[model samples]
Target: MNVDQIILQSVIAHRLDTIAQEMGAALERSSRSPIFAEACDFACGVCDHKGELVSQLNGIPILAAAGSFSVQAVLEKYTGNIQEGDVFIVNDPYRGGNHLPDIGIITPVFHQGELVFFTVSRAHHGDIGGSVAGSYNTRATEIFQEGIRIPPIKLAVKNSIIDEVLDLITYNTRNPQMLKSDLYAQIGANKIGQDRLRTLLDKYGLKKVKESIIQLLQQAEDLTKAEISKFPAGSYTGEEWLDDDGFQETPVKIKAEVTYEVNQVTIDFTGSDKQVTGFVNSSLVTTKSAAYIALLWTLSPEIPRNSGAFRPIKIIAPPGTVVNPAESAPVTLSTLHCASEIISAIFKACAKAVPEKIPAGFGRYCGPSFYGIDPRNQKFYVGFAFCCLGSGGGKKEQDGFPYMAPISNYGGVRAPNNEANEVQYPLLTLNHHLEVDTAGAGEYRGAPGIKYQVQFYGPDPSIVMFGDGMKIAPYGLGGGKEGSLNRNQLFTKESGNEWLKSKTAPRSLQPGDILTLFSSGGGGWGNPFKRNPQLVYEDYKNGYISRESALKEYGVVLTTKGIDWNETKKYRGIDYESRYNV
Candidate 1:
């Protein structure tokens, strides 16, 4: 290729990326729910006519890849019926979707009466009608109880809205107004993407545009392969476990064996447990998306996230397993819990090959859904809060960030503002602060978890807690200590505070009842004795760790005269058995 062609390819690639970003901005500006507008739990992508991802804007990593699968499903279902000004929507896990709440909207772009490209948007709806109020039925045993599942269907045909289809979807969800508004926002974003792509096509001509896309994809593939070749060829095994399947008291396992050979990687989940009776199962699309996210994080940050970037990666999770459950299995909580475990397992395997690139374990998942009726307005409200307790262990150079969401949803699901949340629901947030001494102990301590309290203001509110990392805290690596466990409790005026289970059964909270949540902390990395004493003193001064904990956990003695170097050295040298007298 000549210099002009190379320059043209770079310009076209930048244009495609800009189009994806514009779609995201449009969705954020038009969405009604705070989860979409404030939290930004949505993804926008531009694909080729063949449904292969070309460029995807920043959002949830899992949802970004899931959009490609959803577009492929639509293409397969509506082969020749696809035309200009037609839009299709899908949110069926059985049909290439991540879950029921993550709705996907796809639009086709035509130039000169020929299909040239496709634009897609996928967003998580706050509530879809289900057995539970927030659509996250932790106790659900079957997929039917999760929520309404919609297959690939044309939401708009020839620039005409399908009122019947729209009505059916909105009527089923608890928040009808928000649902309707968000759906339209998705449609508007798709239209914007379609127009932008068409303009580029017209300016560069079809042949030139198509050639540029091919060149971009090839460049991404080459870059990814070169990065993969840096890792030594070998197989590494790693395993992770959920607290339970929300049914039994026993732990559920998710195992993976990752193989790297000749610039290619394969992850096999042959030893993972079978599908459980609870709603923790993950669909095939979700499994693939989770694996892709882990692989993407492990590789160099410079690689472009296109279909070609995933060409050299393979994931094998047999059907009927927790990672790849059957159609009948419940999966409402898969993306939150199961997908997190999968990512952790892959990270553990990669650590064996590239320890410097992988940090210690982080908080797995935390989702607390609250719903009740407002006596003042005589209306029902469902509040879905995706809170993060803490981040993973520190890297070689820096400590991890606090209250970070799971790897798959980084920067996408933000904590809702306190004032906005109170105004939207019939509840009051008493406190949302970091818990002291909850971080794992190491040379560079992990981030501390958060502690929050909420009280009901109106009628009895039903609370459903879907979380993990209770019985077993986040694991540590390189001789670091494990993080603290999660705790959920309720304190009522009539009844004193009582501990609640991780996967608590739906129960109503009386007026003036307060619910307290202590999110789990991240695991630590490296040996604690190697930590700097000045940093430990700074942590104590900042109130992150109590004085007693600093002495016991870090062996740092503080007094009115400052550091007691002799006592500190003695404490640090004492073995665990000798110090504790076990």
Candidate 2:
């Protein structure tokens, strides 16, 4: 293509991405739930008529369906019957969704009386009714117990809202008003995408606009392939494990074998273990999304995030494995647990292949779900107290960030404000801070872990501990050490401060009960002894690490007179204390 054509294509791509971002803005600003509004757990995208992902906003990477299975399900169910004003919804893991808690809303865009694009807004609702209030079911072995599974179905037709569908879904969840409002917010968000796409079509004409999109997809594919061609052509393997749900003797594994060709890569999960009785089983979409996320993170940022860009990467997720469970298997924990493992395993696999691009393992999700009646307004509340947010592993270029959520989304999800959470629910935040010496030590240290505590004063809310990254800590790369583990405890007069499982059913709580969470720290990158003594002293000075840790873990001696360079040099086994400009 000529310069003019390339310029036009770039403009069109920017507009498409902006449209998706506007949808997310609408969803977050207009939604009722803190999970969607404050934490930003949802993502928006635009797909082509053929259900191929065209453009997606950089939201939650875990929600990287990007019109793959989700859009295909809608097309297959309502292909010939789709109308301009129709809207579809789905949450069935087997059909297209990553799990039951994540509900996807699809809106078709018609231009010049032809199906041209579809807008999607996928969000994780706080309460999608299951056997319990919060959707994370620990003892669940079947899909039915996880939540109400909604297949691809019309939530709206011919621009008319279907009250029945809205009513049905809202009725199942505990907080109907919040769920209903959030659903409408999602629907409205998709409408923005549809409107934006139509406006773009009107301005550029459908023919030119569609042609530009096609060219953009091709350009993405070319750029991605070109980047992959630079990697060493060989097979590499890596694996990560999830904490057992007390039912198993050992942890669950999520492994990956990556094979790199001249211009393509393939990730195989054949050696992974079969589906377990726990809810951590991964759906195929979650597994594929993880593979795609891992590749996208390693690739050039200039590469557009669309389905075409991911064409060079193929995932062979064998059925019945933890990476790709069979139909009807419980997958409520897949997004947080096994999905994170999948990304880490791929990163580990490519450690030798692309050590510069690969970072160490990240601390997984340890947030617990709680639901109860708030005495403030006589309203029911459901929330995943995100104050228990963890850390991200270190990289060659940068240290991991503290208070990071799960590695699946890579902090696409935010930590809800403590003040806002307190006002929203009947809870009082006591403490939420980083603990000293909790970070994995290396040349680049991992983000430190958090110690969060909260007290509930509501009319007896029930809290369920449901997540991973406890039994096995985040693994480091390039000789870096592993990070810390997660721990949860419930303190009440009756229970007298008892420990809680990472995965379990909801337990009733009394008023004035306190909950404490110790989120895991991230893994490190490179050798710790090689780390700069100055940086170590700074960490010690800032109170991010203890003096003993700086001496023992990082081999840097510190005193009131600052670091003793000669002692540090002797400890690091290096001749010189040369300062390297980072």
Candidate 3:
């Protein structure tokens, strides 16, 4: 903590940040999937030799969480003397990694031939070997069907690729070139971090760097405890549901009970549903990461995420449950679906303890429904690019984001106009717009979802719609209203063909047949009766809500020109007592 120590620490921290940026740039430049380069679906980090996270890139949150487990896996497997050029790779959830697509590369940093720390990068590839075209199989029953599962293995030694390992990866994946290039990009990112660490050590010396790491850890631990001290020591429980497991078409529940003690918090998932025969089961590590997402967001949004930030928190999810599934359960889509419920549960728990800081429930899943077809013509044209719409936001001091990507707190980049699915694939664009009245209705209104219509341009083909948020309506908070449900269908204008009564459509889509996707909106905050009349009128003018529906949902009657204030007063009857149940 002396002046010289402070200066050395500052320089080392700066170098760590630079390493993260370099890793991100390498992935962005070399990755093939738009999900990685465009959406930034990747993460990189540095960890102590003991496998504790030291520094990480400001990349995707879930991907960043997996970095800790990846390091631990590599360290546990490598028992021999450390080397200057050893690198490891892992992508199996049972082995404490993320899904197969989120392949992680780890490289150990050495100074004077002594192991000091580890540099790691994880990127979500577009495809891993799976039963479906893309690794995202909506109907996958087991982990074996999802893709190749790589236990801790040495993918690279020093600066060269392990040819046998590379060959194994390429042989398993349908898109070998893309996966191979992205894998190398991750490896290269780690190398940049290694070089930067060496330079810092050479200048500041290894002892100072290690001492600075100790200080950083202490600071993070102190901040987490201070944040938790603000909340009263108590237990809070909340439950949310998934529309259905891939096998069954009925909603499954996930429950969380968070207990706050004197400087510590424990999130227990004992009441969650049993594992199902689908890809929605989550690993213990992924479940812990998802829980941390909500706790970190509420306690201290400004806090840096590393091992220390999690010192004051403990997460427990029983085996065989959706939140924390058994080792054998399929977890390919666990983070995509079950993780959302975990976030919602955390939000619900924090809202009870700190109502002002937490917002009401937002729309949970703005699904990127993945589909594809392989014909005799060219390379497989798969479709996993979907947009956000209709999910509600929490009622913070202000309104929540409409159709926003919740939990992960990310957004989708719209593809170019000419790049329609029909132009490239054997698909036709139908209806693509906002779905009206799909949002949760309340004093603070949740955002509404978007609608899209799809038709086949060629022969009958199969399409998979991996969707959620239908059965469990995004619940409202503190007197807020519940959001609307999701919908999907197959329509045909020629034969007056309309959608069949089904929650999800898994049938083959024939030529001349139409498919409609209805995204759900978020719920509203507070009682609708207290909503501002002028705001209701503005919504009518803005085409968000019709004049009649506004009067019905918000208790605000609108005149020909605008909202009728006097008539609204006549209809205003806020039943906050029953609505909030506080």
Candidate 4:
């Protein structure tokens, strides 16, 4: 190709990426749900006519990577019926969806009557009603109890909204008006994508744009392969476990065997545990998306995450395993686990190959979704306590960020703003501050856990507790100490304060009931004794660690003036000459 063609190719790629980003921005600003508008728990993507992902703006990493699957499902179902101005929606895990709560809206972009591209948006709603008030029904045994499932269907035809379909979906969810408004926001976001993509095509012409996309795809494939070849040829295995399957007393495992040969790689989940009776199962597409993001994290940051980026990496998720469950299985909490265990497992499996790139275990998501009648407005309100979100794992060069949604989110889903949340819900935020001494001890300390309390003032709200990191804390790596376990408790005037389960069906709450959430700290990386004593002293000064922890965990003796290096050396069992070496 000539220089002009190369320049045009770069322009086309960035234009498509910008279009998807615009879609994301639109959704965040217009969506009604706090998770969508405030937390930004959504993803947007632009796809080729064939449903091959071209460019996806990163929102939620797992959700962004899985957008292509939803588009492909729509294409397969609609076939020739797909036309200009028509929009499609799907949220059935069996039919290329992440889960029930994450609904996807797809729109076809046509230029002068010929289909050219697809715009897609997938977002997690606040509530998709099921057996319980919140969607994370731990007692649910089947998908039916998880929530309402919407298969690949036309949400709009020829730019005309289908009122009955909208009514049916909103009718089932607890927050009908919120759901309806959020759905419309998704529709509007996709519409923006369609318009922007059409503008790009008009400027560059269809023929050149098609050539550019082909070159872009090939470029991504070549870049990804180049990165894969860097890994040493070997078959490495790693395993992770959930606290339990919500119902079982024993933990459930998700194992990974990663193989790197030449420029190709394969991830197999042959020996993972079977599907459980709880809602922790991962859908096939969700599994693939999780693996894809894990690989992307270790690969060259420049590699475009288009369809071709995954050409050299093949995923084998065994049927009926926790990685790929049956159609009827409940899978409401799969997204949360992607960061906690699945992605962590893959990172561990490839640690020997990419030691510098892989990070330690992230604090798993262990929050609750609560709903009740708002006495202030005489209406029902549903809210996600993302304030219970944990911190990130430690990296080689940097400490993990505090109070992140999950590792799977990659900072896309930020912690809910306290003031914004209070305005949206009928709850008072009592505390949202970091808890000192909760970070795992290592060369680079893991992020510290936090204390979050919310006192509900409405009548009899139900709280559905789901997620891990309670019984089993985030795992440490490279001789580092493990992070502290998560703790959930309910406080009331009658019942003083009682511990809550990691996974339970549903519990009713009285007015003025305070929910206290103590989230898990991120796992640390490397040995603690090797950490810089001065840095440890700084941590003590900043109140991140107590004086006792500085001495016990880091073997650092804090003095009135500065660190007592002589005492530190004695505590670490190393002489003055050898103190810095280890």
Candidate 5:
């Protein structure tokens, strides 16, 4: 291509990306729920008339990829009926959706009376008519018990809202006002994207704009292929285990074998365990989304994300497996823990090919769901709190960030603020802080986890805990120590304190009762003795590690006069390497 054409294509690509970003901004600003506005658990993107992703905003990568599948479903079902000013919504897991709560809205745009493109928005509703208030039923054995499942249906037609369809959705949710407002926000964002795309079409004309999009997609494909070709062709395998399926004591295994060939990479879950009778089974959509997230992280950031970029990557998980469960399997909790395990397995497999590029294991969701009637207002409240805790594994030169979302969602979901929690619900925060000696010991130490206690202030509330890494701690690499295990407890005024089951069924919490959670830390990298002593002293002075742990774990000696250089040398000894086989 000539320089002028190349410049034009770049401009068009930037415009498309800008439109997606604006859609996300609209959703965040207009949504009513803290999960969407504060936690930012939403995604926006644009696709061609053929339902191929062209550009996407920065949010949850897993949710962003859902747009293509959702759009394709709508187009196929409503082939000749699609018209301007029409919007369709879908959240059926069997119909190209992650789960029931993550509803997606698709709106098509036409240029000069011809179908051209589509704009899509997706967000997680806090509650969607489930047996449990929080829509995370740990004991649910089927999808029907999880929540309402909406197939692809028209939400608006000819620029007019469909009151019947809207009412049906709102009536099924616990918080109708919040759900209605969020749905409108999603629709409003798509309208904004529609207008922007039309403006671009007007400026560049249909033919030229279409040509630019084709060229842009090709550029992304070429860039991604070049990056994939850099890895040496080989087969690598990784395995991970879940504590339980919330129904049995036996652990469930997830095994992944990644094969890299010339300019292509394929991940197969053929050896994964069979589907379980719990809510942890993952659907095909969630499995593919998790694999996409893993590959996206491995590729260079310069490569533009579009359908073309994924053409060279393949994911396979046989039907009835935990990773690709049957349609009847409950999958409400799939994306939370199972998705993280999938990503962890992929990273473990890739470590053999590119050790420096992968970090150690990070903790997944280890939080509580509280739902009850507030005596003060006589109103019901449901809260899902996935609070901050430990850091991820250390990188080649830097330590993983602590208290961030797991690799699956990354920074898209934020932990609720302590002050906000007290004001929004009938609860009181007793204590919240970082736990010391919880980080995995290595050359670069893993991030430490958190400890927090909450007490019920009003009537008794129902509480359910969801997470993993309780029995098996986050794994460490290169001889690093494993991170601490997750712990949960109940402190009742009548019965004293007792350990609560990791994946506990919902139960009542009397007033004045306290719940405590200790989230797991991230895995560490390399050997602990190789860590810098000065950094160890800093960790000691900052109270992240005790002097006793320092002495035993890193062979460091400390006194009132600070670090004892001679004593430290003697503690480490000259033959430390040979003694420990470091």
Candidate 6:
């Protein structure tokens, strides 16, 4: 390529990024759900006519990566050729992406009446019609119960809305008004991206813009391969367990076998448990999107993530397994539950290959927990409330971020205020704070857990809590102790009532019933004995750990002002086991 070609490619790439940002801003401004506007639980990307990702917003990582496939699925399934002003929408987990709640819309851009590019936007609506209020039932046995599935259909064609499709969606969902408004917001975002892409194509010519996408993809592929080659040429295997499959009381396993050869790496999920009769089953596209993100984080954190970064990596998951279930399998909580285990296994594989480069495992999975119900007004009000929890940190790094949403990191940034929650639903969020001493102890302590309380104002009979990770805690790295397990409890103003049975049972709540959620903390990294005394003292002073627990778990002696290093070492070195053989 000549100098002019390089310059033109760079300019086009920058313009596409700008287009993505504009689409994202429009979505945020127009969305009715706080998760989209405040939490930014959405993604916007520009794609070539072939449905390859060109650029994306810096919003939710997993959403941005997985949403690309939704657009491509539409392009492949549509019978008629895509023309200018053509728009398509789909949310079928079996056909394309994660679940039915995340609706995606694709618009084909035109330059001089020629189809030049496409723009796609996806957002998680508040509710999709299902057996459960939140559309995600922890104990759901089949996909039919999850939500309404919509295949590729023209939401808007030539700027004219499709009334039939809109009517079908509205009829199926409990919140038709909110869904309709959010659907238009998604369409509006895609339109903004389409306009921006057309403007860029007109200035640079379609040939140059297309050439830039190819160049951009090639650059990402090269950088990714270079990073993979740096690791040792070998295969590594790791496994993690969910507390139970919501049906059986025993633990179920998910395993990963990662092979790093030449410039490419493949993750094979064999020996994983058969797909459970629950929402734990993850779709193949969702699995690959997660693995790709973890590999990028481990190998090339700075490289732009588009279609290019994944050209060198392959993901293999046998059908019927947990990672790649059949089309009928349910996957509403893939982001919260199964996806975390997949990422944890991949990161563990990378840590084994490059220990210094990787930190120990932070508690990867949390917040498939759903808590809420439908008020008498027929207005669907629900909450995926336990999303705020810390992850276990690696040795070199502090415990993973506290109350941070795993895989996506969408929950941590400024949360929706209590007033917003009250305004939207008939529920009151009384408390949302960090759980004390939830982080496991080590040289580098894990992040603390989160605690939240929700009280229902109106009569809503069914409220489910899909909390997992009870029996098997989030494991630690480098000989560190595993983090604490999660806890869920029910309290009421009335004198006595037996607690609901297990993680799967839906709580039948009265108007004044109060629910408390204690999210688990991440595990520590390295030996606690080696943790700096000053840091230990700081932890106690900062209210992260109690003084007594620190002395017992970390063997640090607390003085009036801070830790006494010499005294701490003397007590830490003492073998209490020798004195008391109990």
What digit string (tens of lDDT, one per residue) describes model 4 on residues 1-582? 999988989888888989999999999999877888888899999989888899998788889999989989998888899988788989999998998999999999998888999999999998888988768888999999988999999989879999999899889988799899999999999999998988898998999999999889999999989988887889989898889987888988989999988888899989999999888899998899999988777787899998989888899998999999988998888988743578878888988677778777777888788888887788888788887788887878887778876787767887778888888888889999989999988888888898999998778877888888888887777877788789999998898999988886788888889999999888788898888887898888888899999999989999889888778878887775665554
lDDT of 2 at 165: 90
If both were scored by TM-score, which would come out higher, candidate 4 or candidate 5? 4
Error of 4 at 88 (Å): 0.2
Error of 5 at 353 (Å): 1.6
Clashing pairs in 5: 391-402
Model 5: per-residue lDDT, tens digit, 1-582? Answer: 899988988899999999999999999999988788877888999999988899999888779976788998898899899998899999988887888889999999999888899999989988898788878888899999988899889999999999999999989888888899999999999999999999999999999999988877888788878988888789999998888888998988989999888788899999999999988888888888888778767767888878888788898899999999888789987777688888888988988788878788886667778889888898777787756444576756666577866667776777778888787788888888888988888788778888888889788788888777788788887777888888888988889999977788888878999898888777888888877777888888877789998898888888876777668779776453454343
Off by over 4 Å in 6: 1-4, 363-380, 390-392, 408-414, 494-502, 572-582
If both were scored by lDDT, which would come out higher, candidate 2 or candidate 6? 2
Give the higher-lDDT candidate: 1 or 4.
Answer: 4
Q: What is the lDDT of residue 182 in candidate 5?
A: 93
> Candidates' lDDT values, in order?
0.85, 0.87, 0.73, 0.87, 0.85, 0.74
TM-scores, all models, native as reference: 0.95, 0.98, 0.90, 0.97, 0.96, 0.92
**Which window of ten consecutive residues has the lowest lDDT sum in model 4?**
573-582
Runs of candidate 1 with Cα error greater than 4 angstroms are 387-389, 571-582
lDDT of 3 by residue, 1-582 (tens): 788878877777777877888878887777766666665678889898888887888776777866889888877778574567777889999885877777888899889978888998987777788776667766677788888999989877776778998999878987787678778788888888888888888987878788899888777888888888888789998887887776787878888898988799999989888988877788877888888888888787766788898888898878778877777678877666787778888888778878767666655553443444545475655555445344546475555566555455334322323144455556667667667666666677777777766667655565566657766677887787787766666566455555433223345665667766676777678777677666667767766777667977888788787655556657875443354342
Off by over 4 Å in 3: 2-11, 366-377, 388-392, 409-431, 456-461, 492-507, 510-513, 573-582
lDDT, candidate 2, at 358? 81
Report the C-alpha lDDT of model 2 over 500-562, residue by residue, as the tens digit: 878867789999999999998999899999888888988998888999999999888898999
